[model samples]
Target: MLSEQKCEACSIDAVALNKGERDTLLLELSDWHIIEREGIPQLEKVYKFKNYKQAWAFSNKVSELAEDEFHHPSILLEWGKVTVTWWSHSIKGLHKNDFICASSCDGFVENE
Candidate 1:
């Protein structure tokens, strides 16, 4: 179970893991559509938009957020959707940073 101190909400949980524990956490989060391909935990949520323009706009918004936070995710953009994944490379494992990014990502979706 995730520790309450690390929980960013019911949806985002912060994990302190070393290199060895990373794979395990990544695997676990992957079960929820998150993956550990970028040397960290990742998730690609398909955001639906009414048109290509809106999709691009949303992608840009996410880009701005990523830049401001100094934590970026691998983004996959399609006609009407954008997929964002979060991970940390320096620690070689999950960190509070990931949860912070997740919370920010969640806010984007929640507010939209």
Candidate 2:
């Protein structure tokens, strides 16, 4: 499964995913969107919750997921929702890791 994939270490040789590659991989994540802000690409998804505590707990779980993968995401916490965007800052674009992280976040919501 996508979430089981591990992120690779950064290297001068690492390259960002091409458009076709990104699009193809995105097929696996139906709820995610590819958004470019200020010319940088990212995979973003918003998750709704029953209440503030549920959302907060979900955010914390995602934090643990990110730490385990060593690929963090930008998390926006709200009263009943959370927005997560995953991107490889070092590459200035999306990577397979971003998609994988996004998948794990989806799993968190699923198992909640």
Candidate 3:
């Protein structure tokens, strides 16, 4: 359902999701987890691949998707894995947009 949604422009005054909302939305994302970096909560997931080429390709796909959605994530491409962390930088916390993007990321692998 989240993958079916599109990200909206987040404003500086936009409120982040509360704990209950985070938990409920997280249920739709099985591989993603919430983590705190410098006290800011983020949704993170590491997708594994066979090699650097596969990982790089996957990261590029995610990048294009983020560009289209206008909601970017911090993506780390490694030898055989890519780590993606999504958070609302303006609000400095997790947002529904993060969950939507995370679900979209999963759809990439599923469709592969």
- Order the candidate numbers by lDDT, best to worst: 3, 2, 1
Q: What is the C-alpha lDDT of each candidate?
A: 0.59, 0.89, 0.93
Model 3 misplaced regions, further than 4 Å: none
By TM-score: ranked, best first: 3, 2, 1
TM-score per candidate, in order?
0.62, 0.94, 0.96
Tens-digit per-residue lDDT, 27-82, candidate 1: 53322245566455554456778878878887887788678767677788889877
RMSD of 3: 0.8
Candidate 2 Cα errors over 4 Å, as ranges: none
Residue by residue across 1-112, what tens digits does model 3's lDDT show?
8978989888768999998999999999977999999999999999999999999999999999999988889999999999999999889999999999999999988988
TM match of model 2 to true structure: 0.94
For model 2, residues 14-94, the per-residue Cα lDDT tens digits are: 899999999999999968999998899999999999899999999999999889878889999999999999999989999
State how far residue 41 of model 2 sits from its true place (Å).
0.7
Clashing pairs in 1: none
